[model samples]
Target: MFYFFFAVAALITGYFVYGKIVESSFGVDTCRATPACRLADGVDYVKMNPKTIYMVQLLNIAGLGPIFGPILGALYGPAALVWIVLGSIFAGAVHDYFSGMMSVRYDGKSIPDAVGHNLGKFAKQFMNVFSVILLLLVGVVFILGPAKLLAVKIGFNLDKNMAVVVWTGIIFAYYFLATILPVDKIIGRLYPLFTACLLIMAFGLSTMLIVDGYTFFPNGVGLANVHPKGLPIWPLMFITIACGAISGFHATQSPMMARCIPDEKCGRPIFYGAMIGEGIIALVWATLGMTFYQTPEALQATLASGGPAAVVDQVATTLMGPIGGFLAIIGVIILPISSGDTAFRAARLIIADFSKVEQKSIAKRLLIAIPLFVIGFIITKTDFNIIWRYFGFANQTLATIVLWASAMYLVRHGKAHWIASVPATFMTAVCATYLCVAPEFPLHMSADYGYPIGIAVAAACFVWFMLAARNTPVEVDAVDSPGVIG
Candidate 1:
């Protein structure tokens, strides 16, 4: 119980301290207008209140990733808490804040543009196609997650072809409509309501956890390796809790809000603050995962009997009774739907941005969106398990790239690059080692070879960055406004 409270306090404290340090280093200024104001298209770049923008950014990134990922990650033991608190604070929030602010600095272009400017043109091209594929995978997974949940809530046997098909159609229809509509009309309006559901669910469950006399982590924190079978803690745990800790996907989504924020000042609260909010939700779910079951082996056995989504239903129903269960159902259902549509929306904008195609016209939007949807829907018909596994490696790989890009932004401007550079290097090592060692990843090298190869590759990346990041005769001018960094 005390440990849970401490975890919450660390997240909040980290926001004020580490989050603010990130904001100051970026030199956020209120006097200047943002691209949302300077480049309003009445479509995606409409100015919104900070609260609404925060809600949109939060829901845009939250999805089923945090909940489902943490449930799976809880299989590792209380070590998940250590990762969630520290990773979210030092790595996740920094990754998210800089990504959002960088978009604002670059006039609300896609991430490829930002990466291109900092890394190189080739990196930009790779990121553009890579991000589109990643978002497509994310889009399909989110759609399938909710449709299954809807089937469960309706008490339908999902094994029946018609039940799964009908739910999929309903969710896919919503995703299509939400993708084409203006931001203010659909996402900006509906997202706040969805955010409210998520918060209420978190708060209610959190209160029950504390008020109902549940003791978590009774043996206390350690490198005890409490996983049912001794899964190495290094890369598996990091990959499992990707979104809650640090994710490349958030970098993609941050620009969507970057195109809506009216002033630079709100970037701190909206972008950095929203990530802190996500960390809190993740902590709650992780705590629930640790306590709601008896042991790691029992948890594994239960997972074998039923999946992560089923665990959410069982836990909520047991802990909160029927009413809490209903609210949890609503919250869980809203999460993936809100995130799924935006995944497609982000993909549309990325492709359009890559083509330099104007997006104001409904016809142009439809032209790009139709093909992507057809491809995504077809991909959804394959085995979801394989798709999700591949996504984790790709997801973290993108994060490593974004972090290095961020470090580049800091270095080119002659500011302290340590903040971004440190985490960037660490994640690079994590992802590289995971691919080599993790049996699921395509590389699949033995652990003995993987660790040395991981360190060597990461060190090589560091050297490459130091060579490439030499001060250009002219600064890249990452910030567009009069707000200049010395």
Candidate 2:
């Protein structure tokens, strides 16, 4: 029953959200020859074949978030998987693909820049402030979660501080390689190999579990033991879905990839297809979580050993022995590295956009990397699950705002009123109201600061949108601007 709804929801969302929103936004010639559309020659800017671009985008965007978010969602049983699948197709994929397309049309501008250009100066500045905060939280939380997970799996005796040091080193290595090495070589040679390994590990684990006669369905599947003081199932489902669906991180990744796509027509396949792939990854993880544990006690024990990563490792080992466990480590490593590379690149772009620093300079890149690593290192000691939840709320709120901005752009440029406004407005309202009303629900973590922050951001955006509508003149110049790919 749950899987039925899950498939239905994913298919519907793919058609409506991914098909319409992203495709319409970045269709052929939509980003041709504008100032925002300039393509640089080298790793970050070199144009690539559409198919290659699609593959690169998929590998980059499909990271640990999808796996962990869906696994967490499975805590509420298969009912949670339905929402995860639906939300990923509709909200998550659309957010990532359109956000990338929108950035491309704005000369490689980010979501914050788009807000400022389409809305007003205040909107841009407000978004920047919120974005930096959100990024800090996201960077720290994401880094820590995977690091801790790895530590537990390997039986590393390092404390949180030491674990952070090791994690930072790994991140730094990826960033260094990405920045210094040619992207084509990396993507052409390395990315495929990495992705192939990921697929092998993923399928190998699944097959092993099945062959071992592991129960395909969780036993005692009920939401009875969900944490009452924590955020409830429905709201947490929304938040978790946001990680898979519409992460703020995508705002950074999409534009970077857009600049590298060989032609304007490639945007749809590269951006939209990548997002769909990410949704599939999330679904896989959700399935794993469901099949692996049947009771709250089992889930807790797995968590105590580590977290979702450990649970995944345990399951793989249970099915395939030590070889599977080793493969799991490699698979886990790929996730953080993929996300970290994107994170570093995104942070560099954001910094370059806002500051006087030149992205071309090695010093400038290092300057940005150092602070980011430090922040990530410091926050490694904090509880990752809590931070991840907060990130979902804040990140999703940003996605809602981006969706509105995209709709406005389509209406103004393409004059697709019904197509543009209806879905966009619906998503905005659903996401906004969900965040705002969520705190009132009887759920664990309801009283957390993240929920209130999300509410405040949503409320402020509502007011900002209203005022901007009344006072500011809409600028459609960006619609024709060319974007830089990197």
> Which model scores highest in lDDT?
1
Model 2 residue 185 CA deviation in Å: 5.6
Worst 10 residues of 1 by lDDT: 477-486
lDDT (tens digit, per residue) of candidate 1 on 1-486: 888889889999999998889988888778878999899999989999999999888898888778888888888888898898998988988989888988998989888778887887788889999999999999998888877777777746546456767888888888898888898998988988887689767888878877877777655666567887888888888988888888888888999999999899898888888888888888888878888776777677777876778888888887789888878878987877888898899999999999988999999999998998999999989887788887788888888888888888887776788889888999999988998998776688888899899988899998877766664333656553222111
> Model 2, range 234-303, lDDT digits (tens) per residue?
4456666555555666666677676666566666567766776676666666667767676645666776
Where is model 2 poorest over a 10-residue stretch in terms of lDDT?
Answer: 477-486
Model 1 regions more than 4 Å off: 155-161, 471-486
Clashes of 2: 18
Candidate 1 deviation (Cα RMSD) = 2.7
Poorly placed runs, candidate 2 (over 4 Å): 1-22, 25-27, 30-37, 41-43, 152-164, 176-189, 218-231, 381-383, 417-486
Candidate 1: lDDT over CA atoms? 0.84
TM-score of 2: 0.80
Whole-model Cα lDDT per candidate?
A: 0.84, 0.62
**Which prediction has the highest TM-score against the true structure?**
1
